[model samples]
Target: MKQLVFGTLPSRSTDQATVTMGDASESSQHELKGQLLELSQLVEPAEVLHAYAEDYISNTQTWSTAKDKKPRLVLRPTTIESLCRVIKYLHDTGLDYKVRSQGFGSASATDVLISLSAFDDFEFYKEEEYVILGAGGNWRGYYDRMEAAALDWSIVPARTPSIGIGGSTLCSGFSWLSSQYGCVSDPANLLDAHVITTDGRAFWAAEVDPDLMWALRGTETGFAIVTHFKFRARPFPENGKLWAGPILIPRTKVAEVAKGIMSMAEKDKQGEMSDRVAMFLYVMRKELLAFIGATQDMLVVHAYDARGEAAGREEFRWALEMEGAVDQTRGDMTMGEVGRLQEHIGELRGTAEAYWAPICLTGEDEISEDIIKKSFGWWTSMLDEPSSIANYGYLLYELFSCKDNLTGRHSSAWPRPVGYKHMLLLGAGCAPNETKEISDAAKRSIMRGPEAILGKTMKEVDIVPNCIEDYHDVERIYGSHFEKLRQVKTRVDPGDRLRGWIKPSRHESG
Candidate 1:
C-alpha cells in the first residue's frame, strides 16, 4: 500500500510560481500525511493543502486575544459540503479543532482552527429583515449595509470592524450597545446554524433543537462547528446618542463604585426614568468606564460631571455624576469617537501569545467584598513587581444580569449555572518572550482574587463561566440531548474523524 502522505512539497495547482527557500543551504522536507482518506467528500488535493499551507505561513494567521494557542490546522473550505468533508478528515485523525468566524484577534483561545474567511456566501432577502451569512464574512460589511439602508438594528455588533461577528457574539460578546440592546443572543439569534459535528455531520441548529441550539449559541466550538449563522436584526434608532467616558475613580474606591452602580441598577428598576437598557461596567486599568447607547438626545446622565468644559458638556456632566468617578473628569465623546479613544486599551495588555490563567474555581460564587479587594490586590502587586518591562496585563470581572437582550449570557462552549465568574485574561506581544513569572503572576493574582472582592460575603471563588473545563459537567448539563448530538456525530462521521482539530464534544466531553 502507498503511504497516504507523500514527501513534502508535492506540488499540484492551477497557476504556477516557483519560489526559492533562500536562507537554507538545502531545501528541507518532511512526509505529508493526514486523515484525508476518512472524508467521504471531495477535498482540496494534497497539493492544494501544501500550497495553501505555504501561503498561509508566509502571510497572516487568525486568533483572538486568547494566548499560547494557534490553530494547529487552519481549514478554509469553500462550501458547506467541503467544510464537512475536511472536518471529517480531521476528526478521523483525532485532532482538536476550534472555530473562528472572524480573523483570530487578541481574544481567541484555541490552537487548531478552521477559518471561514474563504467562504464569502451572503444571502440577503429584503423583506425578511435578516440575512444568512457564511461565518467568515466580515462583520463590518453587515453593519455598513444596515447603516446605508438607514436601518437601526442592534444585535452583537463588533466594536472593531476587523473582528469576526460569529466569535464575538458566540463568546463573551459585548458591544457599546450592550447596555441598551442587551447582549448578542435572543430568540432572534436562533434563526439557523450550519454545524459540523465531531463525527463530521453537517447540520443546522435552531430552537427546533433547543439543547443543541443553546449550546451552539453559548458554548465555544465544542458541540459542533458553526459555518453559517442566520442573525436577528430589526430597525432601531439610528441617530442615537452615545454617552461614554472614562471616570478616573481612584482604585481605593472600587468597592464604593460597585455599590453605587448596583444601587443605580436597582433604582433604574424603580421608575427612575422611562428609557430602558442594561448598564455598561468595565473595571479597567485606571478607571471604571461606563456608558450606554440611547435613542433619546438631551438625556440626563446621572448628576453632574465636575470635569472641565468639553464639547458635549451637558451630556458629559450627567454621565460623570452618575458614574461618581468625581476625583477628576475626562470629557465625554460620541459613541464612534469613544471607540477611537479606547482603541489603545486593546494593545495595552502584553501580547498576542501570552495567556491569562483564569482565576476561577469550578462551581464557585464571587459575591463578596473581600474577594474583590484581594483579587485587586494580587493583580496590583503583580503589576508593581519587578518583572519584564512587558508582562501580560490582567482584566478582571464577571457580568451579572437577569439574562435578556441580544447579548444574553457569556456565550462560551462552556456555560455553568454558577454565578460571579472572573476571567484573569493575560496579554503579551512576543509569544516566545512571555515568561513563566508573568504567567504565574497572572494566575496567582486570579485564584487569590476572591479574597479581595468577595471577602466573607461571597460563597465561593468560582471558575469563569465561559470555558470548557470538565467533561462530566458538560454531560450533566446537556443530559440526553448531548448524547443524541454525539450519536448524530457518530453516525455521520463514523470513523471518529475530526477528533481534536474541531471534535464534536470530546475535550472534558467535546
Candidate 2:
C-alpha cells in the first residue's frame, strides 16, 4: 500500500489559471468542458456529463434544494486509477472542485463536481470479521446486501437508509446500535479507509498513516476524498431480528407521552435501562397517520430493542399500554427493515428546504418535562402559522443509554460531548419560495425551544456536528478539536481544493 507524505507538494503557482463559475467567460467555460471531456477518455469506464444532461441535473440535486448549485461539469470515475488521474488534473490546474456521494449535506460546488456513485462495491471477509464498502452507495443498498448474504453479522452505520455510508461514517454515524457500539467512526468499528489526497495520491490511511486515519474519523469531509471504508463487523443481537416500530398517540395523549419519555430518561440516567434499547419520539403533524385515516397532531414513539420480541415488549410496555394510543406497530423486524422505517419520510427530499441543529443533554442534569413541552409547542407553532412554509416540520428526540467502551481508542475528530444521554434534533422545513428573512427567522426560532429547556443561550450549548445549519459556528461545532483539525487541514489540503461543509483555515502552518 502507498503512503501519503504530509506537506510534500510545492506551493501553488501564482500565475496558474483557474475558472470560477461566477467570473468565467463563455469561451473559458467551453474550454474547461472540452478539457474535462478529453480527460474522461484517458481511463476505462470513466465518463463526463455536462449540465444539460438529465443525469447531471439529478446528480446535482440535494436533500435541501437551497444548497443545490449547478456545476460546469460532472465526472464519474469507476476505478481508482481514473479517479486519481482526474483529481490530479484538477489539482494541478487549480480548478475548483467538490466530491459528492449522496449529497445529503449543505455543501455545494459550482465549478467541477466529482460523483462517486460508480464505486459501489461491497466485500465481506468472514474469517476476518470485517467488510470493505465503497463510498458511492447509500445505507439502504448496504443493508440489502447484508440481508442477501443471510449473515448473522452487520456493521454499525447510519440509522436512516438513504444516508450515504461514507459521509455518515466520516461525520460520526449515530445508529440504532450506537449505544452498544459507540459510533461507526470509532476505531473499533471504522477499521480503515482508502483515501485519495488533494495531490491525487491514493493510499490506505490505516496501513501507514495513523494521523490521517484519526483525522478521517469524524473530521467532516474537508481533509480528502475517501473512496472506500473498512469496518469491523459484529454479530447482530438475536440473529438480526429486533422488536422495533412506531407507536402513534394522538395529541390528546401528549401529556402522557411526555411523562413516559421523562421516565425513560430518568431510568437511562440511572443506568437502569438496557444499552440494547433505543427510542425516538417525533412531534409532528398527524399527516403521517393519513394511511390509517387519522388527522390531528400526533406524537410518535419509535422504540427498538436488540433483544428478542418478548424483551422489547416489556421494555416499551409504557408506550404500548399508554392511554389514547391511536396505533401500535411494534413487532419483530430485521435490521434492514428497522433501518428503512424512515424511508417514506425521506422521500420528501427536494420538496422543501430544511434546517437542522442538535441539542445534547448530559447526565449531570435531570431530564425536564418542561423541555419536552416547549419543543412540542415550537412544533405546534410552526404548523399553526397560516400559509407559512414552516407548516411541515418535526421535532425529534433521540434517547439512548450511554456506554463508553471505546475510551482507549483514538478519539474521533467529531467532538461528541461525553455522557450525553439524549440528543434533540430540531428541524424546520419551508417551501422553496420562502424569503431568506423568513427562513432565517424560522431557523432561529427552533433553537429557542432548547434554550428555554436548558436555561442557557445558544452559545452556551454544545452543538453536535452531525446535523448543523450553514450559519453554525465551525469553531464551536468542533469544540476543542477545532485547532487540531485546522492543523491537519493546513498540512493535507493546504490549497483548499476540495469544497466541503468546513473550509480549511486561512492561516498557514509555520
Candidate 3:
C-alpha cells in the first residue's frame, strides 16, 4: 500500500485477522481486500477492515441494529482529503460503498463502508455569527463548545445530541428555531458546504455545484459526501436560555388535551403561536405514565420557548388549563442544562436497536381528533404488549410548524412543507436479534393510526432529517425531487458506487 499524506491523522494500526469471507464470495472478498488495502494507503488516516479484524468490529459496532450491515471492508476516513481519496478510489474501482455518519439507520449489509467520525471539526466565527463544522460532530459537541466560549448563538441541530451534523444538515435539519428561521438546511441558514462527489471530485458545493447543494438540503445518501458545513447561527434568548418542560394530562382528560393540541396547531398555522414556541404530544408507557397517576394511560405535552417561565404559562394557557393536569414543570434553562436534564432515554443511548419511522400531516387533518385518539390508543396498546416492554419500543409526536418565510435561494430536496403542520416520529428499540420484529410491529401499530389517517406510508412521510432506513420506497420519501436528485446522482457518481445508501427505483439512475 502506497503511503499518502493529507488528513490530520496518519494511519491506524490493525491486528492480523482470520479472514473468513462469509457470503462475500471468497474470490471477490480477497480481491476487494487487496483493492481496499491499496486505496487505504493512498489516503491519510484510512483503515481497511477484513472480517474478524478488530478495527472492523469497533467501526461496525457503532451502527444501529435497525440497519446494521456487515461490510467486507470498512474505511474510516479522518480528514476531508482522506475522504475524497476514498470516494475517488471506490468510484474508479466500481466498488459499492455506503457512507456512514453516526450510523443511525445505516444497518443495511454491505462489503464496503466509509465512516466520517474522524472529520469532526468545530469552529466558531464570533463576529460573523456563523459556525464552520465538519460533518462528523454531534449537536452536543457544538452546544458544549458554545457553552465553553460563552457564545450566545446556536445553529439548527437535531433534538438529540448524538445525531451527526452532516446527516442532520443535509437531510433538512429540524431545530428549536426551525419555525422562526426555516429548516437548518434551508439555503438561508446554510452558508456553504465542502463536498466530494462519488466520482472523487472535491469542491465547494455552493460555488461549483448549486444543484447538488439544493439536492442535499433534504435528501439522504444519493448525491455526494459532505465534509464541512457553514451555518448561520441564531442568537440565544436574552437570558441565554430557553423555557422548556412537559405538561402532563391524565387519561381522564385525553380528549381535552387532544383538543388543546389541535387548537395550538391551528393557531400556529395562522401565525398566532410565537415562533419561539414548539410543542409535541406523546403518550408515555405505564411506568412513566403512572407518575402522573390517572388510573389509565396519560399524555405528556412537551413544549419549549425562548420566553421565560412566567410567559410560558401564558403561552401554553390552553394546555395548562386543560382539566386533569397531573404535573408540569417549565423553566428557563441553558442548552447545556437542558442536555443534562433530559432523561437518559435508554433507546436513544444506542444500547438497543433504534429504528425511527415518522408520519407527517398537514392542513385541517393535522388537528384531527379522531386521528390523535386512534394514534394514542394504538401507541398505548403497543406499550402494553409484552414485546414492547421487553424491547423498549415507543413513539412520540414531533409537532411544530414549518417556517413560511423561506428565502428559497436554493431548491431544497426536502419535501415542500407547504401544508404540512407537524409530524410523529415512531421510535422502536430491541435486542439486536429482535430489531426487525419489533420494528415491523411498531410500524404495524403506527400505520393503523398515523399512517391510516394521514394516508401516507413511511415512504411518503416528510419528517425530520434522520438516518436513512432500509426501506424500499425512498423515491416516495424524496417525492417530487427524486428525479432531479437522481440526475444529480448520475452527474456526481455515474458508476453508482453510493447506491447502497438509498433504495433505488426500478428505473432510477445512479
Candidate 4:
C-alpha cells in the first residue's frame, strides 16, 4: 500500500502499519499482531485459499482521484459461508475494511469516500415480494423484479436508473414518494441483513425485537459490513411518472414562492392513507422551477401536473407577478426517459460528492410546510457554493394528508389547525465530492436562514417526517424511543463491529 493517510473518524490516528504492513512497534502493535496471527491461522493462508489474496479496497474518491486508497489484498468469496470465513479472518486480525454495494454511484453527486467498484452482488426473490439483494444491486434491477408483479415497494435507490440501492438506503439517504409513504424505509420492508464485522465475524442482523429494527436503519453500517439485505413487502403504483421539469420563477420571490406552495401543500395534507406527491425546485438562468412526481404512482400524475402547475403558477404570480416574468415550459419528461433527468441527478449528485461525502444524512418524510421550507433551504445550501448557479433538489415537500387532516389511519398527536396555509417550498442539490468547508457552510445557511424567513409559527403548523428512521435532529423526533435502537445495536453487534465508520466502541475491544 502507498503512504496513504487514514483517519479514525470522530478522532484521528496514524497507521504505523504503513511501514512493514507489520504490527505496531510496541504494545499496540503486539496486540495487533496477536490478533492478526490468530485471524490468519483460522482462515486459509493467502497461498492456499482460492478466494484469498485478491486486491480490493473501497473509497468515495474515484481511482483517478489523488486521495484514493489502494488495497494490499482483495478477496472474492462466492457463498455466504465463504464470506463468513473471510470476515472472521479480518475480524480476528483487526484489519480495516469497507463493504460496498456495486451500483452505489454516489461519487457523481457526493464526496463519496467509498465505491462499489471492488464489490458487486445482486440477488432478490422475485415472486415473494421479498428480496435479499447485495448492497450492490441497482434499484432498477431490483425494481424490474418487483415491478413485474405490480409490487408496492420502496428502496432508497439512486436517483438515476444506475444508482446502487445500498449506501443510499443506509447513509445520506432520502426519498421522492416519502411524503405520501413516509421515508422509503418506513415501509418496514427490510427483513434481514448479512454483515461482516470490523474484526471480521459474520452475523445476521435481524431481530423480532423492534429496538433492533430501529438500529438497523440508523447505525448498522458502521457496526457491521452489510453483505446483503432482506426487505419487507410493499405495494408499487400501477405505473410511475415524473411531473416533468421546472415551473420558472424570478429570483426575488424565491422565498415567497417557496412559502406559498408549502402553504397550499400543507392545507391539502389530510387523510391518513393518501396517494403520495413530491415537489422539487431548482434555479437555472436566474429562474426557480420545481419538479413534482412519483416513482410508482403514475395514475394521478397528469391530474397532478395540471393541479401542481396551476398551484405553482398562482403562487409564483402572487409572489413574483410584480417582478413581471415570462413563464416557459422548461420541458415535459419521465424518469424512464433518462437523458437529462439522469444527467441532472448526476449533476446534482456531483455537487454532493464535492461537499457532504462522509457524513451520511439519514432522512424521514412528513408533510409539513415548516419541514419542507426548512429542509429545502437546508439541503440546497450544501451545494450553493459549489456551482455558479447552485442546483438544489430532493424538495419532496408534497403532502400525503387527505380530507380528514387531523385524523388518519392510525391516530394524531399534533394540534390540527383549521387550515395550515402552505405549498412546497424547496430545492435539491446533487454533486459529487463536496468538500467539508462547503457542506458545513451550507448547513449553517439553511439551518438558520429558514427560521428567519418563515418565523417559528410555520414550524408549529407543519409536520416534518422523513423517508428513513431518523427524526432529524429533534432528539425527541422519535420521542424517547431511540433508546431501543441503542439497545438493539448492543445486542446483535455486541462486540461493537458497527464502529468501523468511527472508532471501535468503548464498551468493546478489537
User: Which runs of model 2 end up more than 4 angstroms from their true locations?
Assistant: 1-46, 50-54, 364-366, 401-405, 408-410, 447-449, 501-510
Going through the candidates in order, what is the number of backbone clashes in each? 83, 0, 3, 88
Q: Of models 1 and 2, which has the larger TM-score?
A: 2
Residue 296 accuracy (lDDT) in model 2 = 80
TM-score for each candidate, following the candidate numbering: 0.64, 0.89, 0.85, 0.56
Give per-residue CA lDDT, model 2, range 23-66, as digits (tens): 57887877765565555554443256655556765456677767
TM-score of 2: 0.89
- For model 1 the local lDDT of residue 300 reads 16
- Model 2, position 324, has a per-residue lDDT of 64
Candidate 3: misplaced stretches above 4 Å?
Answer: 1-20, 43-59, 62-64, 107-109, 238-240, 288-298, 321-330, 339-355, 384-393, 428-431, 435-443, 446-451, 455-473, 500-510
lDDT of model 1 at position 362:
22
Which of the predicted structures, 2 or 4, would earn the higher TM-score when compared with the native?
Answer: 2
- Which sequence of candidate numbers ranks them by lDDT, best first? 2, 3, 1, 4
Query: If the candidates were sorted by their TM-score against the true structure, best first, what order would they fall in?
Result: 2, 3, 1, 4
What digit string (tens of lDDT, one per residue) describes model 3 on residues 96-122?
567876524452335567777667777
Lowest-lDDT window of 10 residues in candidate 1?
A: 1-10
User: Candidate 1 overall Cα lDDT vs. reference?
Assistant: 0.43
> Which of the predicted structures, 2 or 3, would earn the higher TM-score when compared with the native?
2
Report the Cα lDDT for residue 71, model 2: 60
